[model samples]
Target: MAEWEDGFWSSKDGLRLHYRDYPAKAGSTRPPIICLPGLTRNARDFAPLADRLAGDWRLIVVELRGRGDSERAKDPLSYVPVTYLEDVTALIAEAGLDRFVLFGTSLGGILSMLISATMPGRVAGLLLNDIGPAIDPAGLVRIRGYVGRGGSYPTWLHAARSLAEVHAVAYPDYTLDDWLGMAKRLYRLTPAGRIVADYDSAIAEPFKVPGNESAGDLWPLAEALKPIPALLVRGGLSDIVSAGTADRMQAELPLLERVDLPRIGHAPTLFEPECEAAIDRLLARVGRAG
Candidate 1:
Protein backbone atom coordinates (compact mmCIF):
# COMPACT_ATOMS: atom_id res chain seq x y z
CA MET A 1 0.00 0.00 0.00
CA ALA A 2 1.15 3.53 -0.77
CA GLU A 3 1.57 6.04 2.02
CA TRP A 4 -0.31 9.35 1.81
CA GLU A 5 -0.16 12.72 3.51
CA ASP A 6 -3.13 14.80 4.65
CA GLY A 7 -3.12 18.36 3.27
CA PHE A 8 -4.97 21.60 3.88
CA TRP A 9 -4.95 24.83 1.87
CA SER A 10 -6.84 28.07 2.29
CA SER A 11 -9.29 29.05 -0.42
CA LYS A 12 -9.35 32.63 -1.70
CA ASP A 13 -12.26 33.40 0.60
CA GLY A 14 -10.43 31.96 3.61
CA LEU A 15 -12.08 28.55 3.76
CA ARG A 16 -9.68 25.78 4.74
CA LEU A 17 -10.03 22.95 2.20
CA HIS A 18 -8.55 19.47 2.38
CA TYR A 19 -6.82 17.05 0.03
CA ARG A 20 -4.99 13.74 0.23
CA ASP A 21 -1.49 13.61 -1.26
CA TYR A 22 -0.07 10.24 -2.25
CA PRO A 23 3.56 10.16 -3.31
CA ALA A 24 4.97 8.28 -6.26
CA LYS A 25 7.10 5.15 -5.78
CA ALA A 26 10.57 5.72 -4.39
CA GLY A 27 12.88 7.51 -6.87
CA SER A 28 10.16 7.91 -9.49
CA THR A 29 9.96 11.21 -11.39
CA ARG A 30 6.55 10.99 -12.97
CA PRO A 31 4.41 14.10 -13.23
CA PRO A 32 1.95 14.46 -10.36
CA ILE A 33 -1.77 13.80 -10.81
CA ILE A 34 -4.39 16.13 -9.29
CA CYS A 35 -7.83 14.57 -9.09
CA LEU A 36 -11.07 16.54 -8.83
CA PRO A 37 -14.26 14.77 -7.84
CA GLY A 38 -17.79 15.03 -9.17
CA LEU A 39 -20.46 17.35 -7.78
CA THR A 40 -21.77 16.12 -4.41
CA ARG A 41 -18.63 13.97 -4.14
CA ASN A 42 -15.51 14.35 -2.01
CA ALA A 43 -11.87 13.25 -2.09
CA ARG A 44 -12.79 9.80 -0.77
CA ASP A 45 -14.33 9.01 -4.13
CA PHE A 46 -10.81 8.78 -5.58
CA ALA A 47 -9.25 6.69 -2.80
CA PRO A 48 -9.46 3.37 -4.64
CA LEU A 49 -8.14 4.83 -7.86
CA ALA A 50 -5.43 6.82 -6.13
CA ASP A 51 -4.22 3.74 -4.29
CA ARG A 52 -3.80 1.94 -7.60
CA LEU A 53 -2.07 4.81 -9.43
CA ALA A 54 0.05 6.18 -6.59
CA GLY A 55 2.94 3.83 -7.34
CA ASP A 56 3.30 5.31 -10.83
CA TRP A 57 2.57 8.96 -10.06
CA ARG A 58 1.97 11.26 -7.12
CA LEU A 59 -1.79 11.73 -6.60
CA ILE A 60 -3.55 14.63 -4.92
CA VAL A 61 -7.24 14.07 -4.45
CA VAL A 62 -8.92 17.32 -3.41
CA GLU A 63 -12.01 17.78 -1.28
CA LEU A 64 -13.79 20.71 -2.86
CA ARG A 65 -15.18 23.17 -0.26
CA GLY A 66 -18.24 22.03 1.70
CA ARG A 67 -17.37 18.41 1.06
CA GLY A 68 -15.55 15.89 3.27
CA ASP A 69 -13.63 17.53 6.09
CA SER A 70 -13.41 20.88 4.31
CA GLU A 71 -15.04 24.02 5.66
CA ARG A 72 -18.40 25.03 4.25
CA ALA A 73 -18.74 28.19 2.21
CA LYS A 74 -19.92 31.33 4.04
CA ASP A 75 -22.08 31.99 1.05
CA PRO A 76 -23.85 29.10 -0.61
CA LEU A 77 -23.46 30.88 -3.96
CA SER A 78 -19.71 30.34 -3.67
CA TYR A 79 -20.25 26.72 -4.72
CA VAL A 80 -20.35 27.72 -8.37
CA PRO A 81 -17.70 26.55 -10.83
CA VAL A 82 -16.15 29.97 -11.21
CA THR A 83 -15.59 30.05 -7.47
CA TYR A 84 -14.27 26.50 -7.61
CA LEU A 85 -11.78 27.57 -10.25
CA GLU A 86 -10.40 30.19 -7.90
CA ASP A 87 -10.08 27.61 -5.13
CA VAL A 88 -8.33 25.14 -7.43
CA THR A 89 -5.87 27.82 -8.50
CA ALA A 90 -5.10 28.61 -4.87
CA LEU A 91 -4.55 24.89 -4.25
CA ILE A 92 -2.06 24.66 -7.12
CA ALA A 93 -0.10 27.60 -5.78
CA GLU A 94 -0.21 26.31 -2.22
CA ALA A 95 1.02 22.90 -3.30
CA GLY A 96 3.87 24.53 -5.28
CA LEU A 97 2.78 22.61 -8.36
CA ASP A 98 3.92 24.20 -11.60
CA ARG A 99 2.47 21.49 -13.78
CA PHE A 100 0.45 18.28 -13.39
CA VAL A 101 -1.90 15.85 -15.06
CA LEU A 102 -5.59 16.46 -14.27
CA PHE A 103 -8.04 13.63 -13.56
CA GLY A 104 -11.54 15.03 -13.21
CA THR A 105 -14.94 13.45 -12.76
CA SER A 106 -18.16 15.25 -13.82
CA LEU A 107 -18.08 18.74 -12.23
CA GLY A 108 -14.37 18.25 -11.77
CA GLY A 109 -14.08 17.64 -15.50
CA ILE A 110 -15.80 20.96 -16.20
CA LEU A 111 -13.40 22.69 -13.82
CA SER A 112 -10.44 21.12 -15.66
CA MET A 113 -11.51 22.80 -18.89
CA LEU A 114 -12.01 26.17 -17.23
CA ILE A 115 -8.61 25.95 -15.55
CA SER A 116 -6.88 24.89 -18.75
CA ALA A 117 -8.52 27.75 -20.59
CA THR A 118 -7.29 30.32 -18.07
CA MET A 119 -3.83 28.84 -17.53
CA PRO A 120 -3.09 27.26 -20.87
CA GLY A 121 -0.28 24.68 -20.97
CA ARG A 122 -0.22 24.23 -17.21
CA VAL A 123 -2.18 20.99 -17.47
CA ALA A 124 0.18 18.33 -18.85
CA GLY A 125 -2.72 16.04 -19.60
CA LEU A 126 -6.43 15.65 -18.87
CA LEU A 127 -8.66 12.68 -18.07
CA LEU A 128 -12.32 13.67 -18.21
CA ASN A 129 -14.55 11.04 -16.63
CA ASP A 130 -18.10 11.04 -17.96
CA ILE A 131 -18.51 14.71 -18.82
CA GLY A 132 -18.65 16.62 -22.11
CA PRO A 133 -18.78 20.13 -23.52
CA ALA A 134 -22.52 19.89 -23.88
CA ILE A 135 -24.56 18.61 -20.92
CA ASP A 136 -27.87 16.93 -21.60
CA PRO A 137 -30.96 18.50 -19.99
CA ALA A 138 -32.39 15.16 -19.03
CA GLY A 139 -29.35 14.40 -16.95
CA LEU A 140 -29.53 17.73 -15.15
CA VAL A 141 -33.16 17.08 -14.29
CA ARG A 142 -32.35 13.67 -12.91
CA ILE A 143 -29.47 15.05 -10.88
CA ARG A 144 -31.56 17.88 -9.47
CA GLY A 145 -34.06 15.36 -8.19
CA TYR A 146 -31.64 13.93 -5.63
CA VAL A 147 -28.58 16.17 -5.34
CA GLY A 148 -29.79 18.29 -2.44
CA ARG A 149 -31.96 15.79 -0.68
CA GLY A 150 -30.06 15.09 2.51
CA GLY A 151 -31.13 12.35 4.88
CA SER A 152 -29.91 10.67 8.03
CA TYR A 153 -29.69 6.91 8.44
CA PRO A 154 -29.63 4.92 11.68
CA THR A 155 -26.79 2.73 10.51
CA TRP A 156 -24.17 2.58 7.80
CA LEU A 157 -25.89 -0.45 6.30
CA HIS A 158 -29.15 1.48 5.96
CA ALA A 159 -27.35 4.42 4.41
CA ALA A 160 -25.63 2.08 1.98
CA ARG A 161 -28.88 0.49 0.99
CA SER A 162 -30.56 3.86 0.53
CA LEU A 163 -27.75 5.12 -1.67
CA ALA A 164 -27.79 1.95 -3.70
CA GLU A 165 -31.45 2.52 -4.49
CA VAL A 166 -30.65 5.93 -5.92
CA HIS A 167 -27.48 5.12 -7.86
CA ALA A 168 -27.94 1.44 -8.65
CA VAL A 169 -28.76 2.44 -12.21
CA ALA A 170 -25.23 3.75 -12.62
CA TYR A 171 -23.65 0.64 -11.20
CA PRO A 172 -25.98 -2.23 -11.86
CA ASP A 173 -23.16 -4.68 -11.33
CA TYR A 174 -22.21 -3.40 -7.88
CA THR A 175 -22.64 -5.90 -5.05
CA LEU A 176 -23.63 -5.26 -1.42
CA ASP A 177 -20.01 -4.70 -0.46
CA ASP A 178 -19.54 -2.33 -3.37
CA TRP A 179 -22.53 -0.31 -2.25
CA LEU A 180 -21.14 -0.23 1.28
CA GLY A 181 -17.84 1.05 0.03
CA MET A 182 -19.56 3.73 -2.00
CA ALA A 183 -21.66 4.69 0.99
CA LYS A 184 -18.54 5.23 3.03
CA ARG A 185 -17.17 7.57 0.39
CA LEU A 186 -20.34 9.59 -0.12
CA TYR A 187 -21.54 9.89 3.48
CA ARG A 188 -20.06 10.78 6.82
CA LEU A 189 -20.89 9.44 10.26
CA THR A 190 -21.89 12.38 12.39
CA PRO A 191 -21.00 12.84 16.06
CA ALA A 192 -24.54 11.76 16.88
CA GLY A 193 -23.87 8.51 15.05
CA ARG A 194 -26.14 9.26 12.12
CA ILE A 195 -24.82 8.73 8.63
CA VAL A 196 -25.49 11.68 6.36
CA ALA A 197 -24.39 12.94 2.94
CA ASP A 198 -20.88 14.35 3.06
CA TYR A 199 -21.47 17.51 1.09
CA ASP A 200 -23.52 20.58 1.95
CA SER A 201 -27.08 20.66 0.74
CA ALA A 202 -26.50 24.36 0.06
CA ILE A 203 -24.08 23.40 -2.66
CA ALA A 204 -27.11 22.53 -4.74
CA GLU A 205 -28.47 26.09 -4.62
CA PRO A 206 -26.86 27.21 -7.87
CA PHE A 207 -28.47 24.44 -9.83
CA LYS A 208 -31.88 25.60 -8.68
CA VAL A 209 -31.48 29.08 -10.10
CA PRO A 210 -33.42 29.80 -13.28
CA GLY A 211 -31.46 29.19 -16.48
CA ASN A 212 -28.42 28.10 -14.46
CA GLU A 213 -28.44 24.63 -15.96
CA SER A 214 -27.77 25.90 -19.48
CA ALA A 215 -26.19 29.17 -18.47
CA GLY A 216 -22.88 29.04 -20.31
CA ASP A 217 -21.27 27.76 -23.48
CA LEU A 218 -18.81 25.16 -22.13
CA TRP A 219 -17.54 24.25 -25.59
CA PRO A 220 -15.25 27.25 -25.48
CA LEU A 221 -13.88 26.02 -22.18
CA ALA A 222 -13.64 22.47 -23.50
CA GLU A 223 -11.60 23.72 -26.43
CA ALA A 224 -8.96 24.88 -23.99
CA LEU A 225 -7.81 21.27 -23.62
CA LYS A 226 -7.45 20.86 -27.37
CA PRO A 227 -3.72 21.53 -27.47
CA ILE A 228 -3.00 19.48 -24.38
CA PRO A 229 -2.96 15.68 -24.36
CA ALA A 230 -6.42 14.53 -23.23
CA LEU A 231 -8.59 11.48 -22.62
CA LEU A 232 -12.39 11.27 -22.47
CA VAL A 233 -14.04 8.37 -20.65
CA ARG A 234 -17.77 8.01 -21.09
CA GLY A 235 -20.34 5.53 -19.81
CA GLY A 236 -22.37 4.08 -22.66
CA LEU A 237 -25.51 4.14 -20.50
CA SER A 238 -24.85 7.71 -19.31
CA ASP A 239 -27.53 10.32 -19.48
CA ILE A 240 -25.11 13.12 -18.56
CA VAL A 241 -22.82 12.52 -21.51
CA SER A 242 -24.56 11.12 -24.53
CA ALA A 243 -22.79 9.19 -27.30
CA GLY A 244 -23.53 12.04 -29.71
CA THR A 245 -21.88 14.63 -27.48
CA ALA A 246 -18.87 12.43 -26.94
CA ASP A 247 -18.54 12.00 -30.69
CA ARG A 248 -18.72 15.75 -31.20
CA MET A 249 -16.02 16.26 -28.57
CA GLN A 250 -13.77 13.77 -30.34
CA ALA A 251 -14.43 15.59 -33.61
CA GLU A 252 -13.55 18.89 -31.99
CA LEU A 253 -10.40 17.74 -30.23
CA PRO A 254 -8.78 15.53 -32.79
CA LEU A 255 -6.15 14.37 -30.32
CA LEU A 256 -8.61 13.33 -27.63
CA GLU A 257 -8.40 9.67 -26.58
CA ARG A 258 -11.70 8.02 -25.70
CA VAL A 259 -13.01 5.02 -23.76
CA ASP A 260 -16.65 4.04 -23.57
CA LEU A 261 -17.76 1.72 -20.77
CA PRO A 262 -20.83 -0.15 -21.91
CA ARG A 263 -22.03 -1.30 -18.48
CA ILE A 264 -21.91 1.96 -16.54
CA GLY A 265 -24.04 5.05 -16.50
CA HIS A 266 -23.13 8.74 -15.79
CA ALA A 267 -19.53 7.74 -15.01
CA PRO A 268 -17.18 4.78 -14.80
CA THR A 269 -15.02 4.28 -11.72
CA LEU A 270 -11.48 5.35 -12.67
CA PHE A 271 -10.13 2.15 -11.10
CA GLU A 272 -11.35 0.05 -14.01
CA PRO A 273 -8.69 -1.59 -16.18
CA GLU A 274 -9.82 0.26 -19.30
CA CYS A 275 -9.71 3.62 -17.49
CA GLU A 276 -6.27 2.84 -16.06
CA ALA A 277 -5.00 1.93 -19.55
CA ALA A 278 -6.47 5.14 -20.97
CA ILE A 279 -4.69 7.17 -18.30
CA ASP A 280 -1.40 5.44 -19.13
CA ARG A 281 -1.85 6.22 -22.80
CA LEU A 282 -2.68 9.87 -22.11
CA LEU A 283 0.33 10.17 -19.80
CA ALA A 284 2.54 8.73 -22.51
CA ARG A 285 1.19 11.18 -25.04
CA VAL A 286 1.94 14.07 -22.67
CA GLY A 287 5.46 12.75 -21.91
CA ARG A 288 4.55 11.92 -18.30
CA ALA A 289 4.90 8.16 -18.75
CA GLY A 290 7.15 6.32 -16.32
Candidate 2:
Protein backbone atom coordinates (compact mmCIF):
# COMPACT_ATOMS: atom_id res chain seq x y z
CA MET A 1 0.00 0.00 0.00
CA ALA A 2 1.10 3.60 -0.57
CA GLU A 3 2.16 5.66 2.40
CA TRP A 4 -1.32 6.85 3.18
CA GLU A 5 -1.86 10.14 4.97
CA ASP A 6 -4.98 11.99 6.04
CA GLY A 7 -6.41 15.02 4.19
CA PHE A 8 -9.40 17.23 4.85
CA TRP A 9 -11.41 19.22 2.31
CA SER A 10 -14.04 21.73 3.38
CA SER A 11 -17.12 21.79 1.22
CA LYS A 12 -19.14 24.94 0.64
CA ASP A 13 -21.66 23.58 3.15
CA GLY A 14 -18.87 23.49 5.76
CA LEU A 15 -18.61 19.70 5.68
CA ARG A 16 -15.00 18.59 5.73
CA LEU A 17 -14.50 15.68 3.35
CA HIS A 18 -11.71 13.21 4.09
CA TYR A 19 -9.04 12.17 1.63
CA ARG A 20 -5.74 10.27 1.40
CA ASP A 21 -2.50 11.61 -0.01
CA TYR A 22 -0.36 9.43 -2.31
CA PRO A 23 2.66 11.47 -3.14
CA ALA A 24 4.46 10.73 -6.35
CA LYS A 25 8.21 10.30 -6.79
CA ALA A 26 10.36 13.32 -6.08
CA GLY A 27 10.59 15.90 -8.86
CA SER A 28 7.71 14.21 -10.65
CA THR A 29 6.06 16.93 -12.68
CA ARG A 30 3.22 14.77 -13.93
CA PRO A 31 -0.12 16.49 -13.72
CA PRO A 32 -2.04 15.41 -10.64
CA ILE A 33 -4.70 12.74 -11.01
CA ILE A 34 -7.74 13.11 -8.77
CA CYS A 35 -9.25 9.71 -8.03
CA LEU A 36 -12.96 9.35 -7.34
CA PRO A 37 -14.21 6.22 -5.68
CA GLY A 38 -17.38 4.30 -6.39
CA LEU A 39 -20.60 4.40 -4.41
CA THR A 40 -20.05 3.52 -0.75
CA ARG A 41 -16.31 3.18 -1.40
CA ASN A 42 -13.36 5.19 -0.09
CA ALA A 43 -9.70 5.99 -0.76
CA ARG A 44 -8.63 2.40 -0.16
CA ASP A 45 -10.14 1.46 -3.50
CA PHE A 46 -7.37 3.38 -5.26
CA ALA A 47 -4.42 2.24 -3.14
CA PRO A 48 -3.39 -0.49 -5.55
CA LEU A 49 -3.34 1.87 -8.49
CA ALA A 50 -2.01 4.79 -6.50
CA ASP A 51 1.02 2.80 -5.44
CA ARG A 52 1.77 1.85 -9.00
CA LEU A 53 1.26 5.35 -10.33
CA ALA A 54 3.41 6.98 -7.67
CA GLY A 55 6.40 7.11 -10.03
CA ASP A 56 4.39 8.97 -12.63
CA TRP A 57 1.81 11.21 -11.04
CA ARG A 58 0.49 12.30 -7.66
CA LEU A 59 -2.85 10.74 -6.74
CA ILE A 60 -5.35 12.49 -4.53
CA VAL A 61 -7.89 9.93 -3.40
CA VAL A 62 -10.98 11.46 -1.83
CA GLU A 63 -13.27 9.71 0.66
CA LEU A 64 -16.14 11.97 -0.26
CA ARG A 65 -18.74 12.91 2.38
CA GLY A 66 -20.07 10.18 4.65
CA ARG A 67 -17.54 7.68 3.32
CA GLY A 68 -14.27 6.62 4.88
CA ASP A 69 -13.17 9.02 7.60
CA SER A 70 -15.41 11.80 6.27
CA GLU A 71 -18.21 12.86 8.53
CA ARG A 72 -21.74 11.81 7.71
CA ALA A 73 -24.24 14.50 6.89
CA LYS A 74 -27.16 15.03 9.28
CA ASP A 75 -29.32 15.23 6.17
CA PRO A 76 -28.90 12.25 3.91
CA LEU A 77 -30.22 14.41 1.11
CA SER A 78 -26.86 16.16 1.14
CA TYR A 79 -25.14 13.01 -0.09
CA VAL A 80 -26.06 13.23 -3.74
CA PRO A 81 -23.61 13.68 -6.64
CA VAL A 82 -24.30 17.41 -6.78
CA THR A 83 -22.93 17.80 -3.28
CA TYR A 84 -19.96 15.68 -4.26
CA LEU A 85 -19.35 17.70 -7.42
CA GLU A 86 -19.05 20.83 -5.33
CA ASP A 87 -16.72 19.07 -2.91
CA VAL A 88 -14.53 17.94 -5.79
CA THR A 89 -14.20 21.45 -7.16
CA ALA A 90 -13.35 22.74 -3.72
CA LEU A 91 -10.67 20.12 -3.24
CA ILE A 92 -9.12 20.86 -6.62
CA ALA A 93 -8.80 24.52 -5.80
CA GLU A 94 -7.62 23.77 -2.27
CA ALA A 95 -4.95 21.51 -3.71
CA GLY A 96 -3.84 24.49 -5.84
CA LEU A 97 -4.56 22.58 -8.98
CA ASP A 98 -6.33 24.94 -11.32
CA ARG A 99 -6.63 21.94 -13.68
CA PHE A 100 -5.98 18.21 -13.36
CA VAL A 101 -6.90 14.85 -14.75
CA LEU A 102 -9.82 12.89 -13.34
CA PHE A 103 -9.93 9.15 -12.79
CA GLY A 104 -13.53 8.49 -11.91
CA THR A 105 -15.25 5.18 -11.22
CA SER A 106 -19.02 4.71 -11.19
CA LEU A 107 -20.41 7.57 -9.10
CA GLY A 108 -17.11 9.31 -9.60
CA GLY A 109 -17.72 9.15 -13.33
CA ILE A 110 -21.07 10.84 -12.91
CA LEU A 111 -19.39 13.56 -10.87
CA SER A 112 -16.57 13.84 -13.41
CA MET A 113 -18.93 14.20 -16.36
CA LEU A 114 -20.77 16.89 -14.45
CA ILE A 115 -17.57 18.70 -13.55
CA SER A 116 -16.02 18.35 -16.98
CA ALA A 117 -19.08 19.98 -18.48
CA THR A 118 -19.63 22.60 -15.81
CA MET A 119 -15.96 23.41 -15.24
CA PRO A 120 -14.38 22.42 -18.49
CA GLY A 121 -11.12 24.29 -18.04
CA ARG A 122 -10.26 22.54 -14.79
CA VAL A 123 -10.16 19.09 -16.38
CA ALA A 124 -7.11 18.30 -18.51
CA GLY A 125 -8.30 14.81 -19.32
CA LEU A 126 -10.72 12.24 -18.01
CA LEU A 127 -10.32 8.54 -17.21
CA LEU A 128 -13.69 6.84 -16.82
CA ASN A 129 -13.35 3.44 -15.24
CA ASP A 130 -16.07 0.93 -16.06
CA ILE A 131 -18.98 3.35 -16.43
CA GLY A 132 -20.80 5.28 -19.13
CA PRO A 133 -23.84 7.46 -19.76
CA ALA A 134 -26.32 4.61 -20.04
CA ILE A 135 -26.71 2.49 -16.92
CA ASP A 136 -28.96 -0.51 -16.39
CA PRO A 137 -31.77 -0.20 -13.88
CA ALA A 138 -30.84 -3.58 -12.45
CA GLY A 139 -27.27 -2.49 -11.75
CA LEU A 140 -28.40 0.77 -10.19
CA VAL A 141 -30.86 -1.07 -7.97
CA ARG A 142 -28.26 -3.60 -6.92
CA ILE A 143 -25.82 -0.82 -6.03
CA ARG A 144 -28.56 1.06 -4.18
CA GLY A 145 -29.38 -2.11 -2.25
CA TYR A 146 -26.19 -1.77 -0.20
CA VAL A 147 -25.34 1.94 -0.43
CA GLY A 148 -26.44 2.96 3.06
CA ARG A 149 -27.82 -0.16 4.68
CA GLY A 150 -25.88 -1.16 7.74
CA GLY A 151 -26.74 -4.82 7.97
CA SER A 152 -26.88 -6.65 11.27
CA TYR A 153 -23.79 -8.81 11.12
CA PRO A 154 -22.20 -9.74 14.44
CA THR A 155 -18.70 -9.61 12.98
CA TRP A 156 -17.00 -7.89 10.10
CA LEU A 157 -16.41 -11.30 8.65
CA HIS A 158 -20.14 -11.76 8.28
CA ALA A 159 -20.40 -8.47 6.48
CA ALA A 160 -17.60 -9.57 4.20
CA ARG A 161 -19.45 -12.78 3.55
CA SER A 162 -22.56 -10.80 2.81
CA LEU A 163 -20.62 -8.80 0.25
CA ALA A 164 -19.14 -11.91 -1.28
CA GLU A 165 -22.62 -13.37 -1.54
CA VAL A 166 -23.94 -10.29 -3.25
CA HIS A 167 -20.98 -9.18 -5.38
CA ALA A 168 -19.10 -12.42 -5.93
CA VAL A 169 -20.61 -12.70 -9.38
CA ALA A 170 -19.14 -9.37 -10.37
CA TYR A 171 -15.77 -9.73 -8.65
CA PRO A 172 -14.68 -13.32 -8.97
CA ASP A 173 -11.02 -12.42 -8.55
CA TYR A 174 -11.43 -11.18 -4.97
CA THR A 175 -10.62 -13.59 -2.14
CA LEU A 176 -12.56 -13.73 1.07
CA ASP A 177 -9.97 -11.48 2.68
CA ASP A 178 -10.27 -9.09 -0.20
CA TRP A 179 -14.01 -9.00 0.26
CA LEU A 180 -13.46 -8.47 3.98
CA GLY A 181 -11.15 -5.56 3.31
CA MET A 182 -13.71 -4.09 0.95
CA ALA A 183 -16.36 -4.44 3.62
CA LYS A 184 -14.13 -2.90 6.22
CA ARG A 185 -13.32 0.07 3.99
CA LEU A 186 -17.00 0.63 3.26
CA TYR A 187 -18.16 0.50 6.89
CA ARG A 188 -16.90 2.12 10.02
CA LEU A 189 -17.04 0.67 13.53
CA THR A 190 -19.72 2.41 15.52
CA PRO A 191 -19.65 2.95 19.28
CA ALA A 192 -22.20 0.16 19.57
CA GLY A 193 -19.83 -2.20 17.74
CA ARG A 194 -22.27 -2.60 14.90
CA ILE A 195 -21.49 -1.85 11.26
CA VAL A 196 -23.05 1.41 10.19
CA ALA A 197 -22.57 2.13 6.54
CA ASP A 198 -19.92 4.75 5.96
CA TYR A 199 -21.64 6.78 3.26
CA ASP A 200 -24.65 9.00 3.89
CA SER A 201 -27.47 6.63 2.92
CA ALA A 202 -29.74 9.58 2.31
CA ILE A 203 -27.61 10.57 -0.66
CA ALA A 204 -29.10 7.62 -2.47
CA GLU A 205 -32.67 8.05 -1.24
CA PRO A 206 -33.53 10.42 -4.10
CA PHE A 207 -33.09 7.66 -6.67
CA LYS A 208 -35.73 5.64 -4.87
CA VAL A 209 -38.20 8.53 -4.73
CA PRO A 210 -39.22 7.81 -8.29
CA GLY A 211 -39.37 4.28 -9.66
CA ASN A 212 -37.31 3.62 -12.83
CA GLU A 213 -36.25 7.24 -13.17
CA SER A 214 -32.51 7.72 -13.38
CA ALA A 215 -30.71 10.29 -11.21
CA GLY A 216 -30.71 12.41 -14.36
CA ASP A 217 -30.10 12.23 -18.07
CA LEU A 218 -26.34 11.76 -18.06
CA TRP A 219 -26.18 11.40 -21.85
CA PRO A 220 -26.44 15.13 -22.26
CA LEU A 221 -23.56 15.47 -19.86
CA ALA A 222 -21.51 13.12 -22.03
CA GLU A 223 -22.46 14.97 -25.18
CA ALA A 224 -21.52 18.29 -23.66
CA LEU A 225 -17.99 17.03 -23.00
CA LYS A 226 -17.17 17.32 -26.68
CA PRO A 227 -13.60 17.49 -27.95
CA ILE A 228 -12.21 16.83 -24.45
CA PRO A 229 -9.59 14.13 -24.36
CA ALA A 230 -11.43 11.22 -22.76
CA LEU A 231 -11.00 7.50 -22.34
CA LEU A 232 -13.95 5.32 -21.40
CA VAL A 233 -12.77 2.01 -19.97
CA ARG A 234 -15.65 -0.44 -20.16
CA GLY A 235 -15.86 -4.01 -18.97
CA GLY A 236 -16.94 -6.46 -21.62
CA LEU A 237 -19.35 -8.23 -19.31
CA SER A 238 -20.62 -5.04 -17.67
CA ASP A 239 -24.36 -4.99 -17.40
CA ILE A 240 -24.40 -1.35 -16.34
CA VAL A 241 -22.78 -0.06 -19.53
CA SER A 242 -24.56 -1.77 -22.38
CA ALA A 243 -22.68 -2.30 -25.64
CA GLY A 244 -25.10 -0.04 -27.46
CA THR A 245 -24.41 2.83 -25.12
CA ALA A 246 -20.67 2.51 -25.59
CA ASP A 247 -21.18 2.48 -29.33
CA ARG A 248 -23.41 5.49 -29.14
CA MET A 249 -20.82 7.32 -27.04
CA GLN A 250 -18.20 6.61 -29.65
CA ALA A 251 -20.49 7.74 -32.44
CA GLU A 252 -21.36 10.95 -30.68
CA LEU A 253 -17.79 11.79 -29.72
CA PRO A 254 -15.27 10.41 -32.14
CA LEU A 255 -12.49 11.65 -29.91
CA LEU A 256 -13.60 9.40 -27.06
CA GLU A 257 -11.33 6.38 -26.92
CA ARG A 258 -13.17 3.22 -25.85
CA VAL A 259 -11.38 0.18 -24.51
CA ASP A 260 -13.20 -2.93 -23.33
CA LEU A 261 -11.82 -5.08 -20.56
CA PRO A 262 -12.76 -8.69 -21.04
CA ARG A 263 -14.19 -10.79 -18.17
CA ILE A 264 -15.20 -7.76 -16.15
CA GLY A 265 -18.47 -6.11 -15.33
CA HIS A 266 -19.89 -2.84 -13.95
CA ALA A 267 -16.26 -1.78 -13.29
CA PRO A 268 -12.75 -3.07 -13.28
CA THR A 269 -11.10 -2.79 -9.88
CA LEU A 270 -7.94 -1.47 -11.67
CA PHE A 271 -5.72 -3.94 -9.82
CA GLU A 272 -5.30 -6.46 -12.60
CA PRO A 273 -2.47 -6.43 -15.10
CA GLU A 274 -4.84 -5.96 -18.01
CA CYS A 275 -6.54 -3.02 -16.38
CA GLU A 276 -3.22 -1.49 -15.46
CA ALA A 277 -2.01 -1.89 -19.00
CA ALA A 278 -5.09 -0.13 -20.26
CA ILE A 279 -4.53 2.76 -17.86
CA ASP A 280 -0.88 3.03 -18.83
CA ARG A 281 -1.88 3.22 -22.44
CA LEU A 282 -4.39 5.88 -21.52
CA LEU A 283 -1.80 7.86 -19.61
CA ALA A 284 0.56 7.90 -22.56
CA ARG A 285 -2.26 8.90 -24.83
CA VAL A 286 -3.46 11.58 -22.44
CA GLY A 287 -0.02 13.17 -22.22
CA ARG A 288 0.37 13.18 -25.97
CA ALA A 289 -3.23 13.55 -27.03
CA GLY A 290 -3.46 16.94 -25.38
TM-scores, all candidates, are 0.95, 0.89
Alpha-carbon lDDT of model 1: 0.87
Give the TM-score comparing model 1 with the true structure, all chains together: 0.95
True lDDT of residue 16, candidate 2: 71
Provide the overall lDDT of each model, using Cα atoms, as 2-decimal numbers: 0.87, 0.79
lDDT of 2: 0.79
Query: Where is the poorest 10-residue window by lDDT in model 2?
Result: 207-216
Q: Model 1: which residue pairs collide?
A: none
- Residue 124 alpha-carbon offset, candidate 2, angstroms: 1.9
